[model samples]
Target: MKDSILRLKSRLIRTLKLENLLFKFLPNGIYVFNLHRIGDRHSCQFDRNIFSCGVDQFEQFLLLLKASFDVVDVATLSQILDEQQPINKRLAVITFDDGYKDCIDKAAPLLVKYQLPAAFFITTDFVGSERIPWWDEMAFLLRQSTGRVFKSLSTGQDINLQPNTIEKQIAQVIFTSKRDNNHTLVQILDDMREQFPQARAQLAQQSNSLFMNWQDIHQLKDMGMDIGSHAKTHNILARMSTEQQLHELTLSKQVLEQQLNQPIKYLAYPVGRYHCFDQHTLDNAKVAGYSLAFNNEKGKNRFISERYSINRYCFDEGDLSTLKLNCIVW
Candidate 1:
């Protein structure tokens, strides 16, 4: 039923060309779009559909954005917002979170082809570690497990796992961990590792080429790409103490600047959900010498928008219509 409603709405919007009329009403401001990965979805080891934008779809979206608005870089947008300059035309800025190998191999070429500039936020720990992220490791373990039933050590619930039920289990555990402010997710993953000892080796082997190295980052910087900090360990800032948060923010900026020999001025909070960062996190970002900080909150950024909590819109292939609606509405 829900799918039917969405398809109908998409057809209506496309057939009636409501996006054209709605575009006129959209306020002129910086529309920042957050992207994650760009490549073959079928080749991915984890949940690709949620985070990936296929090459073809990404090209289409880029063309549409370029035709409808002026594509600007982070520096240009920051200057415009700082100066309180009037926006005579609509503008859009592109950003990629999580420094994946595909960003350098696939996404960069497309950006160069379009002559569009973008920022790539890097998690300091992952750049040279050659390890899959904790979340991806969790998904991999679940997908590899042969057990049909296992008790959750953190939630004390009996989860029935099957081919169809693995994703739900992963999602529920992650949601609970984020909500509780406890490291229950880590405990759950630990339990899974104990049950499937061989999974760790498999994951390590698979994750060997998932992240970019320092040389790739240096090449990106030389290619005129903006390099920003995505924190050291990608920890939730709000859940950490002030000192830990400061360490994550400061260390990442220092390391990136030292390695790339360029000043890192932007930050995208890890996870970037509402609860992932707080007032203290923003204050620490300022102290860390970051000029701009971004969150994953949905909306456009006005001239007077908060520099420390700038909002961004995240979209995938299935969200083109929703993205258009958000561009006009928010």
Candidate 2:
């Protein structure tokens, strides 16, 4: 009953705000939507890593946006931010990460309905292949294991794991796994594969969590969405050697640019954290000639590496209120 009341209040509040009934004074605005799909709640495959913005909710969000503000691409928003143009109303930009196939199947038509432009960042490794994301392998291993106590290969020490709850397992894996331990990540996954050969085989045959294929990417490019690089294999950059980092960043950009037959222009760091990028990585990005870069931080951009460190909001429930609030604040 309490939850029902809270939802009702949330709906009421959103209805009032949709009509411009609250916070009418704030000026410059930039809203970024993290386009994605919500997969199985308990699936070991990127259960939360890759997003899951369902089609129906996405349509509703677009409907609300159509009724409210002018939609623009990152390029236009950058020009406004660069020129310091005085804008009379809120401005919004729609963006998707991980380059899900749904963006083409589910999202593209809606963009046409409202004539909105968006940006999609693609992780080149997963394109044209069936390789599950590394993180998903880890999640699957942890979930499939029976024991509550497990020791990571690198640490060689036992840590309590709560296999019963997905949230707790996710939190444990993230907190306990060191970002630099690539070898350990691989070994742990191998261990899981040996123990669950059938599961591994099933994963082998399963298509990558529904990514936008080359054809879909081409169609989206023709439809006016900005396509950018999201690293080769979505590895954490800062932990890698400078050369390794350069290869990850530059190769993805080169491949995408060649395919699209246009300047790729933008780069989104894999894992997109402050710690994930260093001076060497930034230098490589600049050398690669990217016009802009985006981090997954959710807020307004204000002068900190705005050229290479733009902020973007991740999608949760694809609720209109959250979308509107994110734009108003950004």
Candidate 3:
């Protein structure tokens, strides 16, 4: 019954293009949207969920965003926030999460073509390294697991994996568990590798082509894109000790700043669900020299909102109607 109503609402919004009208009435704020990968979902092997959209969908989204709101980059948004400038028009900011090679190969080109700017949050370890980030590792292992299930490392909970559906979802829950610790992270990964030995071997071979090397990132910066830290290892900061959390923030920032010759002033929390960060993480971000921080949540950012907890929604839709519905509903 409820889903049917949502579907009808979605249909009306799509058919009538109600979001355009609604956008006019909404309070002025920054509608920050994030993407992970820009490509066909079916072609991905490790984590199909990460594929945000294909080339055409992304180009059209650029059009829709440009026509509707004042599209700005994260740096520009920060400047506005710092100055406490009242928004005269509704603003939108585009971002990409993770250091996927596709950011350079696919998304950047279109962004350049549209003459738009975007900020990319990169998981430092995944850049120029063959090691798969935790989420991909979790997804690949679950897919290769013969039982379609794996025991949660942090809590003895059993995680059910259903392909093309909940595989990555369950992994998100497992990887982002609040009780997660370094020892537990290592234990679960080692357990998965032992349980699914062949899977580890296979994923290792495919890892080389997965993320951007430093050269690719350098070129991306030269293309006029902004780069920010997504943490050194993409761990849930709230789950870590203060020292560990601080280390994650500082190390990632230092490395990025040194490599890119730019101040790393922003952070996009890894597995940035609501529970993924805490007060301590927020404090540590300031200490680490980040002027602004963002998380993966659904909502827009008002100018007076917390700078350390800016909200961003995933905008990985293939259809314009679906995209409109998502942004409206979120």
Candidate 4:
């Protein structure tokens, strides 16, 4: 009970901060992307359709941005940064988080059709695998396990959860994970795994089931997509000790840099919340030699520490107008 309340409080605070920051300024470019956008919710098709822009709503968005400013890629972004001059209006950047195969399948064609350049921030472990993300791992276990769902670390309350409610319940756990003091979320996920043996095995298999392979990354590169680091394991940095955080940041950069045979100067914070990182993490990134880094927090860029903690907004529900608004607002 105590922990649940605390988790709720922290989430409220984080949301308010994000809202406050996002509404305060104008963004140089609109940036948004995520792994899965298809609505079927059941079929995880590799390459079937690329309808993000073809839909009437997204089409109107594409037209609006096209009419507004020069839709540019990472190269142009880098150039603008180098030149230190503000580019014109409607400047937007399209980016997809995690190396989902569908980004290449579904999102890429739409981008190519529109002749827009974008970036793919990839988590190294999934670069060549089909792993369900860690967050999904927890959710899957909760969904597949029979009987009781979660226990409140503070109150020892065991909440009975239906399979359909698993996603929402797991999301609450993620919120719980935000509190520095709560390991209940982790404990619940861990115990749930042991509670269902067959389900655990299935989830373990599926956990390795949904990512872009190394060849896919190359293909994206060939498509003029900018590749960036998303940490090796995708653990929340603030949760790890200093050394662990350093290792995560450095090794991921090295792996991507070697695989791509180019500098990996950009980074996106794993699980990307402000509390998810610290000054030490930024310091470690510099020591690891990154020139710029991005966080998932939505906000406009201003003079900050070495551009390593650059802020970014997420595009959800395929809402192009909100996408454009956040782009301009950020």
Point to the candidate with the largest TM-score: 1
Please list the residue runs of candidate 4 whose C-alpha ends up more than 4 Å from where it truly belongs after superposition: 1-39, 42-64, 152-156, 178-180, 184-188, 204-208, 302-306, 324-330
Quote the positional error of residue 280 for candidate 2 in Å.
2.5
Error of 1 at 163 (Å): 1.8
lDDT string, candidate 4, 140-259, tens digits: 666666367556453466767675665566556556655635563456556656666677787556435567888888888888888888888877888788899889889998999898
Candidate 3 local lDDT, 207-287, one digit each (tens) = 356899999999989988889999998867787899999999999999999999989899999878877899999899999
**What digit string (tens of lDDT, one per residue) describes model 1 on residues 1-330?**
864766676667777879767765677777889988887765666655345578888888788788888998889877987887887778888999889888899888888999989899999999967767767776677667746566666667877778776767766756665665545456667777787678777876663667899999998888898999999988678988999999999999999999988889999998788888999999999999999999997777666458899888887653677788767655
Runs in model 2 deviating more than 4 A are 1-26, 38-49, 81-88, 146-149, 153-164, 174-188, 191-198, 205-209, 302-305, 319-330
List TM-score per model, in order: 0.89, 0.79, 0.85, 0.77
Best by lDDT: 1
> Of 3 and 4, which scores higher on lDDT?
3
lDDT for residue 140 in candidate 4, whole number 0-100: 64
Better by lDDT, candidate 4 or 1: 1
Model 2, span 1-330: residue lDDT tens:
864765575577676665244434435555555655543333435545455456677777777656665778878876776787766556667777777666787888888877888888999987866666666666665655546566665456665555456556654565445354545456656765675566567666765655777888999999988898998988778878999988998899999989989988788887676777877888888888887787776665433345777777776755555755554444
* C-alpha lDDT score of every prediction, in listed order: 0.81, 0.69, 0.80, 0.64
Ranking the candidates on TM-score from highest down gives: 1, 3, 2, 4
